[model samples]
Target: MHIHFIAIGGAVMHNLAISLAEQGHQVSGSDDQIVEPSKARLKKANLLPEQVGWFPEKITEDIDAVILGMHADINNPELVEAQRLGIRIYSFPEFIHEFCVNKTRVVIAGTYGKTTIMSMVMHVLKTLDRAFDYVIGAQLEGFDSLVKLTATSKIILIEGDEYYASPVDHRSKFHLFDPNISLISGVEWNDSRTNISKEDYVNLFETFIETIVPKGTLIYNKESTILREIVEQTFDCKINRHGYKMPEYSINKGVTYLHDGDYRIPLQVFGKFNLSNIAGAYTLCEWLGVKRDDFYKAIASFKSSIRYLEFVASVNGSVVYQDFLFSPYKLRTSIHAVKEQFPCQGLVTIMELNPYDVINENFLPQYASSMDESDHAVVLVNKESIKDKNIVLDDLEQDIKRVFKHKDFVFLTDLDALEGYLESFKSLGFNLLFMVSPKHNTMNIVSFADKFFKNF
Candidate 1:
């Protein structure tokens, strides 16, 4: 099979290209901007585009299929040419569905913890020496690529994202994946370009449940009332609802210990949210025929994905960590997780409202009081971003202040001011947390911390 990718520089797009190339499929791709990691990885695999821009000549009918990435615009020249030539174009999610149609597809979906849960299950499977294909959102420790597909693998674990599949496809990406085994971490709407109303946001997950294959199982977070209601009222699949009301666990001196009736296993990762994710992963593994003992053994060594609670530096008892958290629910969960781990320390939380949904004026209220759990909270937003998005800065700050209900909490639009404020802070044995999505500009914080705490 011959496959060509339009806008293949995307993180997932590049991985899919390499996965197919490794599978012995003749693969070629073109992108307007091929950036780091993707560029280097594709070069190493001999799949990087010779040129940066798209070429209509590259869209020949000889290609078996053309995979379109969300990064590519609808009016992309190669895409237009592909359509003119009557060539089939598959959205990234659609192409994934094509490959896993015959396999037992296990999709993990939610605004948060999907990647972690998928990684956990994949790690367990790999430890068991199970031959399976997978496509997780983040890079795992041992995995060379974010995607792996094979003709012989009978199962595929995918991190199902709810964002749009393509500019032409208005449906959520997860809707394209008809999973035999599905898990919904929780419902927290995002990607404001697609989801306009809260009801519409909730409906997307319902649609995912309705799209499940016959006799398939849905493992959902019963803790989310919205998800529970949607699954109960809308879904007819064999539902196995799981919640956060599991056995108690605690963190002791940076180590997490889980209690399972008579068994207690020490975990390398800490936090209650992570514990819930572990429970969700455990349920999925059990459904996949992994015994309890084996699951525990694999999870004991799990060190979470990169940039999700990743350690940045430590200076005089002040530790700084960065996480890929942007949505209100995720922000609250991450803050609580840090507070739980370092309850005695003064927690300084910095959040970047860079996502389109979070920066929008209409969605500002959803973030109200999301950071109340932190001892000291600061909201960071680029003023130019507000102007670019056509959102009012005063309106955003008012809503944020109202939600936070703290007079000491600061909101800064200038990077220099934020940097100065952070540098001015005296060492107070506090834990500093910086949270934002990958698309946000956070390298400044990383750079500042690296320079200030070089010796530490």
Candidate 2:
């Protein structure tokens, strides 16, 4: 098969191109710009386009398929040429579904925790020598790529995103998976960039529930009132439903252990929210025929990357962590978990306020008291991003201070100033917590932490 990728510079897009290329498909790709990791990976696979920009000449009718990336605009030259030539164009999700049509698709969907839950399931399955395909949002440790496809794998675990599938496909990405087994870790109204209303956001999950195949299994977070209500209202007698909450666990000396009756399974991860994700992952794996004892043994070594409140480094006994937290409920849950994990340490949290949060009038109010658990809360604001979004930063600092209601709240627009502020905390012995999304163009928290604590 021959595949040409439009806007293949994306993290996931490039990986998919490489995976297909490795599978002996003729793969070629183009992008306006390509950065490290993706660029290097593509070059390594000999799939990197000689030139950076799209070329209509490359989109010949002979090409088997054109995988359109979210980064590509609807009028992208290659996409336009493909349309004119009547060549099939598919979004990543659409292509994934078509490629794995015969396999049992297991989708993990929610506003948050889905990535971690999906990672957990993949890790456990891989540990037990199970064969499966998967597509995840973020890169995970021990995984070669974010996307994988196989000819013989009987199951495909997908990290179902509620966001649009592609620039041309406005439908929710999860809507395309049509999973045989699905899990909704939790649902919350979020992503000001999406402009999806609270009601619409809830409706997205409801629609996702409807996408499950007949007699499929749905594992959901019973603790979430909104998700529970949706499950009840969307009840399908043919669909088997299994609800889960935070399972029995004990934290000793900042380490979390999952309790399976008399046996204690120690984990490399921690936090109440993570515990709940574990329960969700455990339920899904058990349903997939993994024995309870084997599941516990394999999951004992599971360590999520910093994308989910994982530790990065320790500086003079002060720990530094990066997490995927943005929504109000997630903000509160993550902040409380970190505080609870290290009750003795002074917590200094730095959260990035993206352009969406800066521009949306309702976004800031949702974060009220969300950072109350932190000893010092700092908001990282990119002045350039605000300017690019055509938003005035008038009174944003004051607005955040007033909304958080924290006595020690601050917002920094300059990276140097933010770094200096963090340096000041060295003497204060405060543990650093970065609650920001990696998708946003900002300083690499992991790289910065490693460099900052190089001596330590």
Candidate number of the best lDDT: 2
Structural similarity to truth (TM-score) of each candidate: 0.87, 0.90
- Candidate 1 Cα deviation (angstroms), residue 451: 6.2
Candidate 2 lDDT over 384-448, as tens digits, reads 67766765456777787888898888888878887776555553355778888657748678766
Give me the overall lDDT of model 2: 0.85
Question: Model 1 reaches what TM-score against the true structure?
Answer: 0.87
* Candidate 2 weakest ten by summed lDDT: 421-430
Error of 1 at 60 (Å): 3.6
